[model samples]
Target: MRPEAEPAMKPVFAKIGKPVAAKFRPDPFQLASLEAIRDADCLVMAPTGSGKTWIAEEAIRSVFQKGGRCWYASPLKALTNAKWVEFGNHFDPANVGIVTGDTKENTDAPIIVGTTEILRNQLYDAMHSGENLNCDLVILDEAHFLGDLDRGVVWEEIMIYLP
Candidate 1:
């Protein structure tokens, strides 16, 4: 890769690299959650329209601001794709990314939205033998999804293995 290529991908490590093209104006609750995400491990259990997703965006921005990375794990493939598209529009696609069952784009983006199963599998493989995920944050949206019998175990396994 060219020298410039590395710098472009280094938003995960660069404080102020290329200017991100878009801006986000989150609601009050999301703003508050965003502000608090840096200080503690948060469990945001709010109503559906309470801007819970923006909290994840704030976590993404925080990680990028600190020269770190965020892994946005969602419960469903549709949610993952939706987040990927949403963030892509709000941020430079080069700096935003996605990973689903069959679709992987801009894997080097500072912000990444993916499926919980994919993230869990990666964590499990990492535990057994893989590249260490040195991310600065992990936002578990729809936290109450641990009740779905089909995919609940994956979520439980992820919570158990998180370090």
Candidate 2:
């Protein structure tokens, strides 16, 4: 039998010249979304790797500037944990807190991060106890997950019950 054909070798590119440092600037779309969020509810849709998270960070900054509280919800616990650490870095560890089924810390902090399911449960508790959610801004990351058949209802309930 003839020997099997050798696989083609892929080309490797050499490192280019020194990388240039570019000044940071916000995209117009990000600016527009931030403005809209200040006046009313806004839904931002963008591809992955886009600066969507920056919009959330700016919004949170505005609320904190006014001495207001914020709640950031993500569809996954891992995302929540990551954001908890990130926002902690941005706003200082003393101001940021996180609550997941596996972990809970500084529950009374001004900036709270947790899974959307936890937020929905908090809403249920608030309704039953007749207490208002003391939050000025609610940032739901990966909001498209609201269409998930299994957990979509929780997100829907949060939208309906959140003030």
Residue 160, candidate 1: how far off, in angstroms?
Answer: 1.8
Best by TM-score: 2
Give the candidate number with the greatest lDDT.
2
Model 2 vs truth, CA RMSD? 5.6
Q: lDDT values of the candidates?
A: 0.79, 0.91
Give the clashing pairs for model 1.
Answer: none
Residue 52 accuracy (lDDT) in model 1: 80
TM-score of 1: 0.76
Local accuracy of candidate 1 as per-residue lDDT tens digits, 1-163: 6456476667765866677788767777676777677677778888888778767766777678888988889988888888888888776678878888988888887777889988898788888885666677887767788888787887798888777
The deviation in Å at residue 155 for candidate 2 is 1.0
Extract clashing residue pairs from model 2. none
TM-scores of the models, in the order given: 0.76, 0.89
Span of 10 residues, lowest total lDDT, candidate 2: 5-14
Could you give candidate 2's per-residue lDDT for residues 46-160 as a string of tens digits? 9998999999999999999899999999988889999999999999999999988998999999999999988988989999999978999999888888899998888799999
